[model samples]
Target: MKDTIEGFLDLVKERNGHEPEFLQAVEEVAETVIPYIVKHDIYYGKNILLRMVEPERLISFRVCWVDDSGEIQVNRGYRIQMNSAIGPYKGGLRFHPTVNASILKFLAFEQVFKNSLTTLPMGGGKGGSDFDPKGKSDNEIMRFCHAFMSELFRHIGPNTDIPAGDIGVGQREIGFLFGMYRKMRNEFTGVLTGKGMTWGGSLIRPEATGYGTVYFAENMLKTKNDSFKGKTIVISGSGNVAQFAAEKSLQLGAKVVTLSDSSGYIYDDEGIDDGKLKFIMTLKNEKRGRISEYVKEYPNAKFTKGKTPWGEACDIALPCATQNELNEDDAKTLLNNGCICVSEGANMPSTKEAIAAFHKAKILFAPGKASNAGGVATSGLEMTQNSLRYKWTREEVDNKLKDIMTDIHKSCIEYGTEEDGYIDYVKGANIAGFVKVADAMLAQGIV
Candidate 1:
């Protein structure tokens, strides 16, 4: 079994040797899914995993747009239509300088399983560009988004590949991209998620991922007859996911002590209350200011210029930032500090070593695919609402999101519990997510 897994990984390495991110994602999936495949005769000798590694479509194009200075700028864009075995391709479009084929492929590969776990009729896919939206004027950002969608518009549609927001892509970028797609296609459709509410966006879409992460954590705590009451949580990232995660944790009677951006993290021992949270929202969402400003507004908080919040003492930690933000040392530090639960709100936020450390410590941890699936699940609901030409109220969308997260937790437990009663969430998420997609691929007969 080990040799078989190694052989598969070797083949993947031969093809994607330069793509470290993609290799990391494949390694994690193969580690668990290979054993399951070996035990299940029907899955054996099918090369199903091999086929899944390859993208159904890899679209790369040049995005040429004019800046505010009237200078034409050129950037690379990509759309990896990874798989549509279970449903149409669905994922987010990230806009950052680091966006590349490797990162997008890794994200798309992870998305395939993540979407499956959501039990939604959406396949895995991801797209993005090397054009950084930061420091760009709104008009400039709009032009870039339009240029990006002009080419991408041909490759996606309502029932086809659907892209949402990630990283630098947000409501503002989605609006511009959708406007371009609408103009080019000559119709108003739910071709994209994260659209403005008036234009067809679903309620709770912005809060879904973060809220879902917390809900999943709550479920994890429940297995041990535990809850978030009076728990201290240290969350990284002040983006949409981090903010809402903090909000939900607070609502559940947890103290959210930290929120960070690229500049640094702020540690507020006072536990970011409603007023401080509102200030953070304005500072980040509206002012586009750095998290260091958080300490300025609330003098009680201490701002660390260039560090993560993992060193803080807490009962729970939510890594809502970018991939590989938490390392083995950070994991060990959290364990030493008596952190019991670590839920990922960002895709692949923990490295292989960090995950190994968590598993060693026997801590309750939820992967992003399972814990942070709310955003895409809600997006699926948005698609349904669009098709029905109706909208769900905030309460309706939020309730559905909660139910979906709960179901995902149930699925994870059904597949992840070990003999010792330690829930190996990684193993459970990998196997459960793999079974559905693998079966779909088998039924499709070598597509």
Candidate 2:
């Protein structure tokens, strides 16, 4: 089994050696999915995994736009149509400086399983640019988004490929991108998600990911007859995911004590309630300010520069930050501090070692693909509403989102239970997500 895994990995590494992030994402899925294939007769000797690893299409282009300074700037943009077996390509478009083939490939690879888990008729893909939106004026961002969409428009459509928002791409950026795509195509369609409510966007789209993460965590806790009624939660990141995760946790009677950004984290022993979370929303979404300013608003909270919230003790920890933000040491610290559950709201936020540590501890740990799938699931819902030319009420959308998360949790349990009865969510998510796409690939006759 070890040799089989290594041989397959060697082949992947030969082609993607320079793409460390993509390799990491593939290796993680390979570890679990290969073992399942060995046990299943239909999947063996078919090389289905190999076919899935390679993208059907990879589009790259140069995006040139004028800045507020009246100077032209260029940035590299990419769209990795990773898989379209189950349905059309579906994923988010990030606009951070860290965007690259490696990262986007990893994201797109994970999106395959994540979308499959959602039980939605959407496939997996991810695209983004190395364009930084920070410190750029509104006109500059609009020009950059328009420029990015000019090239991206040719490859995507309402039925072909649909892109939503990620890291640096929000409602404002989506508005700009959608405006360009609409103009280029001379049509107004649901080619994009995360639009304003007044537009084609669905209700609860912004809050979906965060709300879904907490909902997943709640499901995991229920197996042990536990609940978040009095749990102390620590969440990382101050962005959409983190802020809403905090909001949902508070709504469920849990006390959220922390939120962070790139600069640092703030520890509020008294807990971040509705009023405080509103402040953070404005701070990040409106003012676009640093997290350090949180201390000035609430003197009770202590601002720790250049650190994560893992060191703080809590009953639950949601890593809502970026990839690799939580490492092994942080996992161990959380374990020592009596954290019973860790639900990821970001893509690959916890390192491989950290996951191993969590598994060793036999605690509840949900991977980003399974837990953070709400965003895309809701995006799928948005697509449906857009097609119907009708919108659902907030309660209706929220209820559907909850039902999807519950189904995802059940899927993980079905595939992840071990001989000891411990649920390995990582293993469960990978295999459960794999089976659907693998079957689709088989039926499609090696396309």
Candidate 3:
């Protein structure tokens, strides 16, 4: 067992090759699961953790599509089905040029435990292409989506593997893919989630991640006799997750003053009202443009290039942009400005040093597995609805989502709450999530 752990460490060191953020993510989960595995007699002569770390299936394909000027372009596509012990693989399909097998593998690996933590009958999988959606015409996006889905359709199904949206892939992309899936298969099943309401998509699906994130934050705040009411919030990213997070924060009376994108962020001290938010949404979602367009659309807004406004001061920070966007430097900035709590809207958005900083500061911190789990949880619900051939009301589904998030928070606190009253959610989530899957695997008598 010791040898396996040592060997696993060596492999990680060799293959992953000293990426600070990646190593930090692995170390957090390893610290929680390895000791527990040693204590249990279930794993003997076999390194389950090491085996689980390796992907069950890693697929990469070539995506060739026509550009606006009728030029054929090629991009890489990938799908990392990390685990499926609980159920068919489920996760998001991101469409960002930064996506590669390593990043998607990490996301899918995290999804395994995150799904288990929710007590949902689902497993982990993640796929996407290196095709950037920005600056592409509608026709270009459609062509790309069709080309990508042509190959992906064979490997996924409602009862097999299901996928939804991530950063670059959203409703538009989902719509295009669903259309193609319908054309190819000639059957309309809930194989893919996040469809428009006019189609097979579930209710409250769009708002699930952001709303769930806030709900988790609220539960964490409940532990400390506080809520988001009348607190100031800063959120990075102007995409679906961040936008919805800001919306829920407003509902809870939080004065949210921040939203950003690749170009930079916009700071509106007066708070983002419904009208202003609608404008911002139009700028990003419809226009497929940058956050700098936000200031042009709305007066009394300031845009700064290559700067995050954490140092300006806030009570909560939501880093929803992408992985490692927030680092030790950002953590220090937030700590110096009196940030109280952080709820991740994007998967693994905060670096390990940043997470440690939160712990050292004794401020509330929720890991992405526990916080940003609403998205996949709702996807599970979508699968249930599809299997049953019945659609649930929006209120019913959203309420279920709320309960799942609350329960996930309880699970985190139950396993993560320290004697010192500082819950190490990283450890708590890893242990809690690992126990269920490990026990299940044991009962099944090894695969």
What stretches of model 3 exceed 4 Å from their correct place?
A: 1-7, 15-24, 43-46
What lDDT tens digits, residue by residue, belong to model 2 across residues 248-332?
9999999999999999999999989899889999998999999899899999999999999899999999999999999999999
Collision pairs in model 2: none
Candidate 2 residues lying further than 4 Å off, grouped into runs, are none
Instruction: Report how far off residue 165 is in candidate 1 (Å).
Output: 0.7
Q: What is the C-alpha RMSD of each candidate to the true structure, in Å?
A: 0.7, 0.6, 2.1
Task: Give per-residue CA lDDT, model 3, range 1-447, as digits (tens).
Answer: 567556667787687774544455676788777876777787644567776776778889999999989899999989888877777888889998888877887888888889998898887899999899878888999999999999988888877788888888888899999889889888999889898877777998889999999999999899899999989999999988999999999999999999998788999989998888888888777777788887777779889899765666899998877887888889989999989899998889888888889989989898899999999899888878887878999899989999999999988988887898788777788988888877666666657
Pairs that collide in candidate 3 are: none
By TM-score, how accurate is candidate 1?
A: 0.99
Instruction: Return the lDDT, model 1, position 349.
Output: 93
Error of 1 at 259 (Å): 0.7
Q: Number of clashes in every candidate structure? A: 0, 0, 0
lDDT of 1 at 323: 98
The C-alpha local distance difference test score for the whole of candidate 3 amounts to 0.85
* TM-score to true structure, per model: 0.99, 0.99, 0.95
**How good is model 3 by TM-score?**
0.95
